[model samples]
Target: MMGEAARERRQFWWFMLFALLVIGAGIGLRAPWPADEPRFVLVARQMWESGQWLFPHRGSELYSDKPPLYFWLLGASYALVRQWNIAFLLPSLLAALGTLTLTYDFARRSWNHRVGLWAAAAVLFSFQFVYQAKRAQIDPTVVFFITVGVYGIGRHVLLGPNWRWYWLGCFAAGLGVISKGVGFIALLALLPYALMRWRGWNGLSEPAPRGAGKWWLGGASFLLAIALWFVPMLVTALVSGDPEHRAYLNDLLYRQTATRYVSAWHHHAPWWYFIKVILTQWLPFVVFLPWLLGPWRQAWRQRDARVWWPLAWLLLVLLFFSASPGKRDMYILPALPALAWAAASFMPALVQRRGLRWALWVFSMLLGVGLLAVGLAALFGNPGYEARLVAERGLEVGSGALWLWRVLALMGALIVIAGIVCRLRHVLLFTALGVAVTWLGYGFGIAPLLDGESSSRDLMHEAREQAGADTVIGLVNWREQQLLQAVGPVTEFGFKQPEDEQWRRGIAWLQAEPTQRVLLSQDVAMPDCVDRGQIHPLGAANRRSWLLVDAQAVAGCR
Candidate 1:
């Protein structure tokens, strides 16, 4: 009894530590959520301010790419922060924590506490998971629901056939669908559960009575949950005769789903793409994946109920992402908990294997050397050369690569040294510690630098100040439209627009403007009035050349 209690206590602490590490690392690796996060926050803030729940606003224009759940969450967060900045990322942080909890729960129920701990650790430290958690994007929400669905299914399957758990699974699936459209429901989570149950007779072997009534109840609950959102959306679309509603429906249902299956926008990769992403993103944990596969095959061969279920879950997820035409690096976040489970389940066996310690030590050493070399190079390297290289090659290096390099190098060195110590003592605890430290350093130290550079808050503030409150803002070209929209509403005039024709009429219209301030791109061909000393360059934002035109003097050009 004492031994069992001790084991339970140890597992509890380990799980807690795992949760803390994941959350802490995520918090530390703070990058301003890129691309989607800023837009999501802006729209949500607008929603809060305008009280427009149906139409997502980007400045004065309607922006419709996603559903309302993420925006609603961000809007609430924005109120708390008293600003629509990084605070919007709170949802992602919460989702990440939820993912950790779900992962632990699922692993513990299916396998053992050790596997649970490892799975939790993997979810926390995996590169993509950590990255997504820190960003204010929809992916973390998707991950959260997917995690919940997986855990719910795992519980239902492991604890005999329970309609209650299946209902919970349906609810989770509904949340997942609302979070990121139908893909989470149709592709990632539900299909896996169905395949696992169909192939593995583990569900039938359960001690609980399995009847047709239970299945019908479970199915009805799932359908009802899904209808709650989509049915409302459909009804709303029908009531509103707005052309924009039709556009949104087509974009979400057709373009995003049907087009994604056949065409690639931002996430087009070859079939082997997921393989590389998994290896790199999951890192050292991926090394133990082969052990899981061997056991997986053996379990299926022997028709073992315990092993086939989880293995089936893992395979379904892997196959779904692999077969999908639209693929991104972070698409593997849903599969991570399972991989972690597989890796952790075999960790003890792997630790006992001969030469495993040497291999770990060598891997740690290599990582250390690589990080050190990169850090030194970045620290001493010329900024001009770096910029030139980026410009020439269009390479995407992390903005804070130099800082990240130094931190990663130090962490890697510590891991190598720790691994060497563990090698002599043959302690798996040391190996775990080393990896944890390294992951912590990578997330916390490296993430901030990257985020600082990416954040547009400061830039927006400067632009607003330079342009002044009363300035009638206009884009120099179409390319600047998105950037200007992010800052605030601006009068956009294309080269062929009637507004451009009026502006081309000369200085009289410019001088009659309220603020007499015109923002023009350096790349655009300036009007004759600009060269005639009618415009003065106030200041630059984003290092892009922008000229402030004086409306008073432009009147003489007419």
Candidate 2:
């Protein structure tokens, strides 16, 4: 008994060490928030500065695609950092931490401490979770709420009926609705639990306790919480006189959802798209899924209500997202915690099997090593030839840091070795494997990708430097507009104008101020100048490249 307790204590700390390592690895490989993250952050910042909570703005335009809850949270975070680049990522970081905590709690209660630790480590290290959590997007936030709702429901239904737990579940669902439109998915995820409970009640010879009233109260509270956000938005839409506000309502409520469900917007991949992503995204754990099915069956046959709830949640979320018209890699995040729980339940059995454990460890280690090798090559490998090509062609190399390759290589090798050692010892090898894979993939592999895409930042800085403080910057194309907007203010010249007039005006402007440095996409031809100078290519600190033209060269050309 004493030895077992000592082992448990050591295992507990090991899990903590793995979780912290995953978090630290992510922090080490940092980048500015990508498209949705930065866009949402900007809206949140605008709301905070403008003192308008209901209406979010991006510069002068009203941005209303998403609810204000995430922005509100991010805005509060921004208040502390005062730097948009780093501040916007706070919500994601918090959500990631919350996910880790909830995963740990669910796994610990369902299985043993070791399984809980593995589940937490799996979530922290999962490539999809790591990549999404580092950004300023709402996926992680939605996943957090979903996890909370699942945990609450599991406790309420599995551990006997507790009104407080049910109420907490409702609260989580409400917050989920505010975070994203997918809050109802949580309820769907619980259907398996409801079914199991009903079956258990049927088998009993004695009359079951009547608790419909409790369920009603919980459901009502959830609906009321959701109404707090939705009702106001609906009323504002009905009363607002501005066409733009009405347009926002139409687009956000009807168009976006309807289009997403009925007509594909962006990602129109085949139905099997999610299947591939799930298989690869979960990686080593996906291998253990076969082991879960047997236990899942046993739990269902025994009417083990505790186990079925998480299984139901996982299936329901997967089915719901799979059916949606709009899908992305990140859409599957909400399902991961439940999957982790299910996977963790089988961990002890898996650990006991020497052959199976050895195979898993070897495979995971090799995969980690491969990923690490790629990261290291990207980080340290000289793209000198690529850089020269970009410079010669007057194009920015969009790919980022050479050192990222090295980081990936080193991390991958370490993980592979750890997985093998853990398997050989028949110890808590899964936890070690999970830690190594997550730290390297997230810290070294994905972080470098973010850093490599630094062309936009560099371009913005160069434009600001050359254009002068008072220069009126204008973009020739939408792509240029996106790149320019990311860095500094540059008016979009061609969005509203007729093609002929827009092109003519753009050319004329370039001709009129050849001495004023202007940024143009590589596709655009340089104006005729008497003494044309070379175009200067801007290198991104980490990822992509861009080109900057001298104002004097353009002036001299004509």
Tens digits of per-residue lDDT for model 2, 151-246: 777666665456687678777888888777776677675567556656662222123324778778768867876887778877887797878778
Candidate 1, which segments miss by more than 4 Å at Cα?
Answer: 1-10, 25-31, 79-86, 182-205, 380-444, 450-452, 469-472, 475-515, 520-558
Q: How does each model score on TM-score? A: 0.80, 0.80
Q: Per-prediction RMSD in angstroms?
A: 5.2, 5.2
Residue 34 lDDT in model 1? Answer: 46
- Model 2, position 243: C-alpha lDDT score: 85
Give each model's whole-structure lDDT: 0.61, 0.64
Candidate 1 backbone collisions, by pair: 507-554, 511-551
Q: lDDT value for candidate 1?
A: 0.61
For 1-558, candidate 1 gives per-residue lDDT tens digits of: 899969876876766666557455644244344467656766777788788876666654566567677787777776777654446667887788888877776677667676777678766656577667767778888878777766666676665566677667767766776667642442244454555557665533366446778766656665666676667777777789977677776777777666776775767678888889887777656656655567667666766545555555666766767787778777767777766654566666775655665555566566666666655665677546556433332224664444455675677667667766676455455546655676567566755644433443333445566777766555544232234233554554443345446456434445556464455444346556555455555333333444555565455455
By lDDT, who's the top model here? 2
